[model samples]
Target chain A: MEFLSYLISGISLGSVYAIIALGYTMVYGIAKMLNFAHGDVIMIGGYISFCAMSYLNFPGWLALILAMVVCTALGVVIEGLAYRPLREATSLAVLITAIGVSYFLQNSALLIWGATPKVFSPIVEGTQNIGGLSVSNISLLTMAACIVIMVVLTLFTSKTKMGKAMRACSEDKGAAQLMGINVNRTISTTFAIGSALAAVAGVLMCSAYPTLMPTTGSMPGIKAFTAAVFGGIGSIPGAFLGGILLGIIEALAKAYLSTQLSNSIVFAVLIIVLLVRPAGLLGKYVPEKV
Target chain B: MLKVNDINVYYGSIHAIKGVSFEVHQGEVVTLIGANGAGKSTILQTVSGLLRSKTGSVEFLGENLGNVAPHKIVAKGLAHVPEGRRVFLQMTVEENLEMGAFTRPGSEVDSGIADVYKRFPRLEERRRQIAGTLSGGEQQMLAMGRALMSKPQLLMLDEPSMGLAPLLVEQIFEIIKELHKAGTTILLVEQNAQMALSVADRGYVLETGKIVTTGTGAELLNDDAVKKAYLGA
Candidate 1:
């Protein structure tokens, strides 16, 4: 029973990580940008949703929509101001700018929301029993929602017109532009969608856990990022798989091993994975054209 | 249909294309032939708005193409199929073709795609296959086919024949001729001087970014200097 509980918890947490990892993977795939500010964006999403729920007294659905709208706007502005200028700059310059944006956004939140953690009341309450196992309704909801979102995102990317353009841009921006796809617009839209997904994850996570810290996103963001790399930074499904795998591994380690070395165990897994598959589990090795 | 006047393109401080000038009349196939590093691609890049010229003007169909983004250039009926046959490798051939008409309306774009499939029947067969999986010649065809999907008034091709089998090179050049016959203005840049000049109605010789020579294709092919320098006669 305890093992099943652990498994459920791991899967639930993994679903969140997977959602966040999609943002990291998608941005990296299309823009070849790290977008280190992604975690802070999630932090902002949680705070904004909390603000809408508490201060504006918005209904559940309305608050969720408002949170998404705010996060989308934030994404667009960041891309326009912080990212656009660095579009033609070297990868290093863009990455450093990402770090700068990350710090700036996080600190700005710190100033506005304060450093204390805020409790978020769950949209859905109570426990549910499934197959002789008890699960929190919030956790099950979070998992199901993430799975649906992932499926929709996957289909959108693989089957739609704009999605095709995005894939092209991911493969080669110059080539995409040559095909008459507006590269800049495509990039901006990518950031918007990726951040919006992260925002949804943020809201879902806070609802399930009931705590919204200004820095709540930092650790999870890093973990999601690591999952992105582990699955293959440029591969969409890879990010999902990597995130869930990491989540399950972490949960098992915490359950069976000493809590003191849980983090270390996770890092050790990463190191082993890296040593085995340098390009990542699903990453393809692209040869340089001389 | 395209006029480049005294254009100077600089990469940082290096004058890559210095004082380059040329014209491609409507419905004419104009070739810019040179050795490597001769700024052939640079001229194409500038005309297509991928690279902005430091000094001089590029007018396409009486409109100044100054500081316009590359994608916008396509909307204005100017399409550039960049060097290296830069097809979106991860996308399927159909997706690549769909992206070509990104600026067009949905119905018209679908019709345009149908037109491309008709033009390059091979592309239709490989529509479901990823572009990177295509053979070199097929990829080249997809590249040209993708540019055609933009319904371009003036199509700029950079090094279409690079890294192709000799037979494939012949096929690609033949397609260029056919495209010209279909009333698409072509500005072809090539290091394959011999083949380029043969098919071009008019040819310009670019040496280190400046137009050193310009004449009818046959005239340049027969020019003693061109023969000695480029033709290896």
Candidate 2:
């Protein structure tokens, strides 16, 4: 029973990581740029929802929508302002710029929201007894949200025109352009979707933990990024798989081994997995075709 | 029909194309034969809106293409098969075709893909297979088929025969001939001067970013200087 409880909470934690990982994977897949500022966007989302629900007396759903809107716009603006100009630059240069953007977001959040932490109210309160096991409603909701998001994202990319356009842009930007698909618009749409997902992740994460701060997104952000790489950086389904596995491993390690060594164990496992599959579990190792 | 008027293109500080002017008449096959770095690809890129000319204009269907975005140029009836067979390697053959018709209306895409499949049955056979696994000749065919999915009136092929075997090259040239018979106006850029000339109705010799000479395909094919420099005579 205790093990089951740990697994449930692990899955809940993994769900949040999956949500955050989707943003990283999508942007990396389409724009071929790592938006390290993505984690900071989660922080912004938390702050947005916090201000909305607490100060403005907005409902949970309304706060969620507001955060999504702001984050979506923020994503588009960031892509346009920071990453767009560096499209032709080297990957290392873009990665450095991404780090710069990350720092900018973190510092800006500090200036705006201050360094102090806010006690976050659980968006969904109380617990539910399902099949003789009691679980927090927020945890169940997080898991549900993750599954629904995964299905919706899969359908969106496979069935819709814009989704297919995004896939094409990821596959070959120049060829996609020649096919008369608007590559820039597709990338911008990717950013919007990714950041929107980030907002959902932010809300869920803060709700589960009930502590919100400007730096709250950083650690989870890094873990989710690791999950994305574990599953395959460019594959959506990969992110989900990676996140769940990472969360489970971290949970199990903390429970069975030593709590203080959990993060170290996680990183160590990652190194082993990567050594076996360099492209991650789902990523295709494409030859240098160019 | 397309008209390129005094187009001067630059690659940053380097003047890659200098005062290049040419035209592709309706249903005509025009070949631009040149050595490497002679700006053959640059001219095609300029016409397709990939690279903006430093000076001069490119008019397709009697309208200037200067302000048009690269992605929008195909909708204007000019499709460029860029240098290297840049098929979406990760995508399946059908998916690549689907992306090709991205600019077209949803209603027309099915028929467009059907028409392409009819033209290239090999693509139909490998519809579900990833493009990267395709043979070099097949990838070139897929690239051409992808370009054709845009319903282009003017097809600009850049190095379609590049890196293919001699037999595969002949097969590609045969397809080019077939496309010409089907009334697609072609602007073919090639390093394979001999094959380019044989299929071309007219040919232009590009040297160091300028058109050094121009003539009928047969005339250039038989010219003493062309024979000595390009034909290995």
Candidate 3:
């Protein structure tokens, strides 16, 4: 019974990581740059929703929408201002700039929201007992939301014209441009969608933990990055599978082994998997042809 | 329909194109034939807005294409089928063609795709197959079919025969001739001078970034200098 409960919660947490991982994988796939500020963007999303609900007196649903919209705009702005100029720069330079943006976002959140953690109310307030397993409504909702988002994203990428453009840009930016797809707009749209996903993850995470802090997204951000790398950084389904597997592993480790060793276990697994299959579970190895 | 006037282009410190100028009329197949590193592709890139010229201008259909974005250049009825047949490796042939018509209205996309499929039935057969797995000939067909999907007035092909079997090269050139007969103006950049000149209405021989000779396709094909320099005679 305890194992089942732990698995449930682990899946919920994994969904959060999956959502955030989608952002990292997508931006990296299309723009070929890591937006290290992605995790901080989650913090900003939480803060926006928190501010909307508590200070602005907005409804919960409205607050969520507001957070998504603002985060989408912020993502586009950040890409245009901080990353677009560095499109042709070396990977090292872009990586450093991303780290700088991450720190800048964290500090800005700290200055505005302060160091004290704020309590957040769960979006849904109840528990559901299914087949003798008592599951928090938030967990079920999180999993449901993640599944829905994944399905919709898959449809969007596979069916829509803009989605095809995004895939084309990822494959070859120069060729995409030659086809008359606006490369800049496609990149901005990618950032917008990624940041919007981060917002949802942030809100769900805060609802589950019932706490909001400037550093709240830091750990989850790193974990999600790990998830992305584990699942093939550019593959969407890979991100989903990697997040759930990592979450379940961490949960099982914490339950069976010492709590202090859970983090070490998770990283050890990552290292072993990388050594065995460097491309991650679902990543394809693409060789450069001369 | 296109005119390049004394355009000078540089790749950082290396001047790739030096005051080169040419024109492509509304219904003629114009060929730019040169040896490797002779700036044929550079001229195409500059006209397509992928690279900027240090001096001079490119006028397409009488509109000066200065500082215009690449996508906008395509919207204005200029499609560049880049070198290496740069088809999206992960995407299917149909999806690649769909991307070609990206600037067009949604209502026109289906017909555009159908048109490409009609032109290259091989693409229709492998519509759902990933582009990377296709043979070199099929990839080249897909690349050209993709460019045609945009319904451009002028199509610029950069080395369409690069790394293809001799038979496939002949077939590709036949398709190029067919496209020209169907009224799509062509700016062909090629190292296969014999085939390119055979199909082109006019020819420009570029040497070390300069247009050293210009004449009718037959005139250049028969010229002693061009024969000695490019034909391996």
Candidate 4:
């Protein structure tokens, strides 16, 4: 029963990582540049949701929707203002820009929201006794919501028009351009969708845990990024699997070993995975064109 | 018909295409033959809107293509089969073909794929295979097939015979002939001068990004200067 609780808790944590991983995967696949600011966007979403709920006095569901919209718009703006001009520049230039954007967002959040952690209203506040296991409704709901969104996202990418465009852009941007796909629009749309998913994750995360601060995104973002690389940065299914697997391992380690050792375990797994399968479990090797 | 009026293209400070100019009439196959770095690919890229000319005008069907986006150039009825056979590695052969017709309406897409299959029966046989796993010759066929799926009025092929075996080269050239006979206008760029000229209606010689000579296919094929520089006589 204790193990079951740990498993459930791990799954809930994994859901957050998967949501955040999408942002990292999509941008890296298209632009081949890691958007370090992605996690901050997740933080931004939570803050936006918090503001709507507290200051605007909006309903919980309305705040969720608004947070997604606002976060998506911010994602588009970030791409336009920071990424578009540097499209032709070196990868190093873009990497620095991404880091700069991240720092700027984090510090700005500190100025506006303060250094102290803020309280967020819980999405669910009760616990359920299932087969002698004490499980919070918040955890159950978070896991369920993650599963539902993952399915929708999979379908959206595999079966929809825009999804096809996004995949094409990732495959060969130059060829995709010849096919009459507006590469810029496709890339922008990718950012919007990835960030929107992160926003939903942020709200759910805040509701489940209820404590937030400016630096909150840094840890989650790094973990999610590790998940992205572990699963293959360009493979969606890989990201999901990697996230869940990482979360489960982390939970088990934390429960069995010292808390200090728990942090090292994640990186240890990453190093092992990298050694075993450098392309990642689901990643396909793309040879550089001659 | 297409008209390239004294276009100038640059890569940073390096002048790639210096005052290059040419025209391709409807229902004609035109070949541009040049050595490596002769701006052969650059001219095609400029015309297809992949790269903007530093200074020049590219008018296709009376519409100015200068400064237009790459995809918009495809909508304008120009399909470029790039130098390398850049088939989508992760996508299946059929999916790669589907992406080729992304801009076309759904109703037209099916027929487009069918037409491509009809032209390249090998693609139909390997429809479910991932494009990247194909051999170089097969990938070249798939690249051409994918481009044809777009149903372009004008098809521009860049070095279609680049890495093919001699036999495969002959086969690709035959396909080019078939496309021309089927009334698809073509602008072919190639270092394989003999095969390109044999298939083209007219030929242009590009030397250091400038069109040094232009004539009917046979005229250039038989010209003393062309024979000396390109034909290895």
Residue-wise C-alpha lDDT for candidate 4, range B83-134, written one tens digit per residue: 8978887778888888888878889878988898998899999999888778
Q: What is the interface RMSD of each candidate, in Å?
A: 2.4, 1.9, 1.9, 2.2
Best by TM-score: 3
lDDT-wise, the better of 3 and 4 is: 3
Q: What is the TM-score of model 1 when looking only at chain B?
A: 0.98
Model 2 lDDT at residue A62: 91
Steric clash pairs (candidate 3): none
Model 1 chain A lowest lDDT segment of ten: A281-290
The list of candidate 3 runs beyond 4 A from truth reads A286-290
Q: Write the per-residue lDDT of candidate 1 for residues B118-182, one digit (tens) a residue.
A: 98999999999887788888988988988888889989999999999899899999999899888
Give the per-residue lDDT of model 1 (tens digit) for A1-290. Answer: 99999988989888888889999998998889998899888889888889988998887667777878888889889999999988889999999999999989888998999988899876668899988898998788888977887798899899888888889888888777777778889989989998898888888888877888878888888999988888888888888888888888888999999678877887789889989998777888754231
The residue pairs that clash in candidate 4, if any, are none
lDDT of each: 0.87, 0.91, 0.91, 0.88
Give the CAPRI rating of model 2: medium
For all predicted structures, in order, the TM-scores are 0.97, 0.97, 0.98, 0.97
RMSD after CA superposition, every candidate: 1.5, 1.5, 1.3, 1.6
Candidate 3 per-residue lDDT over residues B15-66, each given as its tens digit: 9999999999998999999999999999999999999999999999999998
What is every candidate's C-alpha DockQ against the true complex, given to 2 decimals? Answer: 0.62, 0.68, 0.68, 0.65
Decide which is better by TM-score, 2 or 3.
3
- Cα distance off (Å), candidate 2, residue A147: 1.3
Q: How many pairs of residues collide in model 3?
A: 0
**Per-residue C-alpha lDDT of model 2 across residues A191-265, encoded as one tens digit per residue:** 999999999999999999988888898899999999999999999999999999899999988999999999999
